[model samples]
Target chain A: MAVREGLLALLDEGPRYGYQLKTEFEAATGGVWPLNVGQVYTTLDRLERDGLVEVRGGAEGAQSQKTYAITTDGVAALGAWWEAVPSDDPPPRDELMLKVLMAIERGDDHALKVVTNQRTVLLSLLQAKRRERRVMSDDSFASKLVTDALILRAEADLRWLDSCEEQLQTRLRAGGTTRPTRKADR
Target chain B: MTAHTLPAPNHAAVEFFDVVKRYGSGSTEVRALNGVSLRIEPGEFVAIMGPSGCGKSTLLHLAGGMEDPSAGRVYVAGRDVADMDVTDRAALRRREVGYVFQRLNLLASLTALENVSLPLELEGVGVRQARAEAREALAAVGLDHHLDRFPDDFSGGQQQRIAIARSIVGRRGVLLADEPTGSLDTATSDAVIELLAELPVRHGTAVVLVTHEPRFASWADRVVFLRDGRVVDDTARTVARSGLGAVS
Candidate 1:
């Protein structure tokens, strides 16, 4: 999703080589959106095949690199995709759920360990993202907006972790075991 | 070691001769299959059993023509698999063989009927006819009520049944099942094995299963044991040694 949007925004700036586009992309994201140079070239090749982009003449020798620019259809398609795109609330794919399910099957202390470790990791990541946001320039509104969104997501994740831990502890104490009754099984 | 002659074309559905598959070169070479040879008859329920890394799964892949043998020839229904081009081999697989993987391999988003209809759809069958045939296949497996349910909503046993329906939907000549009962509980596994046993008898589809469980092997008409890439034992054991007869 980010790749498609970033390519469209870069074309708005001007035409560029594969390597030049990759460098500019990394800089624009403050070096956070790490994209491989090979991936960039591969995606450009696909976009060309899809007729969303076109390659222009090279410097005039076999060793010269071809320059790529977005086609008119590319701009129109990208604009359509952006307008129809749903808000980015990705579904939860929690690996912890699998661990919790297994722990309930085994009826052991493993569930406590898994929840504790997840809490620690989520808290540390939230702190790191907050510190990173503090150092961003206030002058660039776009950069500040992206950073703020990322930090907000991290904060939400941290709160979720807290609630999960509390619920697990309460169940453990009340039931005298970690396993929930089969009726409540997911 | 004596070299065995290939079975007559009409007598065998699959034949393998002195096949060897090695992973790496020189000191790093790992021989996954070493001079293995076997033949499977049409309409026979055969099970290949061995300890882990004994190349049982490799043998199945070779028989199904999904992978090439490093040295020897693999024949499926009298045709040399190695000689067929990719397009022809793919056509043969689609038209003649059905595969049931240990993992259900159902597309999570599609309903049961849609998953069963995939092979026919790939063969250019129109959607209406393909869906009708898929419904018939699901009915054969007693899953008519589940035609509209997504795979994610079903239990493990039901998912396995849906996979079986998908495999046998076309009435393909050969059914290659790689540990079809691996993920189910004992009772469910027994039920699945019974269903697989009934398939060959009812549909005349040759069934070759790769499994490690002794109980599962009991369901086959014949069991061939493998060790270190060679067939070590072949037996006709009608009943499970543990005293569980064919479940009604």
Candidate 2:
């Protein structure tokens, strides 16, 4: 959907050959997102079939040479796309959370161990990302931002692990079992 | 052999062997550190992370000879810290230990150069030689041009750089920072963390940083996690220059 919408938005500016669309899209994303010519043309073909774009010129040569222009409908769609915010209607499943829940189901000790083990792995990944961020030149802002997002996500996971540990400890101190126990019949 | 004559094996910058620290007495006694053993090789960067009251700062205090362990031994640059008398400990701190805190204790009135060179001057290094060394330290932190500027004249990040320069000014063997970036904004904190990361490579100083922020801790060559005065985990960075194994 991103590529489909992206190509539509690109065509809205002016007619562009397939190769030009690929280069401009890659450039617009600070060269961090790579789009091959075949994918670009495929997306363009879908847009054309959907009435979002039309073949303008260079139809006699290779697909890369074919110029595509956005239709009137495409302009309206791009405008709507700009105005629309990303939807999170369906909450996404996170693997770490799932792991913690499963571990809790197994019992408190297992959960604590899981959190500690995950912290080790997450810290290793965070260190790698930070090291990569260090080597990046200042001019690569897009690359740095991408790396920053990954780092922040890992940190958040770590904080959650800490919280999990604290909660597990509190339950243990209270002499509570993770699972409910059966009462004896009177 | 006597503790004084025995060097820390393998040239450790700082080493703790079964260290235990307690506060108060008897029923009221709280173990601030419970049998911790760790080592920092020369020029290695290690970060300590944990919940509050987990003894992260206590570990650093012992490393810099600020406090003696209740049991076991602590060594700084191969000297037994517990064996050293008060004056020798003070001398050890002056010559081998440096500390930075969440709040940089930079004197506001002094210029950057004066603040950095003050430690050297206190140790009886001549004013001229101390100032030259301070200049080099400032240059290392990329603040050479602003040597004469007072702390107030610089931005927060620049001020932190000045504080860092002071910590490493005398070529101290160990640099201990307790949440050095706790007061800075994200961008400024990143810059400060980057500067701290450079200390080991640039000066071969063994650096110990205590921080709750994983982002900052990631910059260290190893991360030690403490819980209730015990090390729960110790992880070395995968791409560490020394390839030291985890201590856990």
Distance (Å) between predicted and true CA of A63, model 1? 99
Q: Which candidate wins on DockQ?
A: 2
Global fold similarity of model 1 (TM-score): 0.52
With a 3 Å backbone cut-off (N, CA, C), the pairs that clash in candidate 2 are none
- Measure candidate 1: CA RMSD: 26.5
First chain of model 1: TM-score?
Answer: 0.73
lDDT values, one for every candidate: 0.74, 0.85
List candidate 1 stretches off by more than 4 Å: A1-186, B1-11, B236-248
Best by TM-score: 2
Residue B11's lDDT in candidate 2: 84
Q: What share of the true interface contacts does candidate 1 keep?
A: 0.00
**Candidate DockQ scores, in order:** 0.01, 0.38
Predicted candidate 2 versus true structure: per-residue lDDT over B87-164, tens digit per residue: 898888878998888898899989989999999999999999999999988898888686788999998889888888
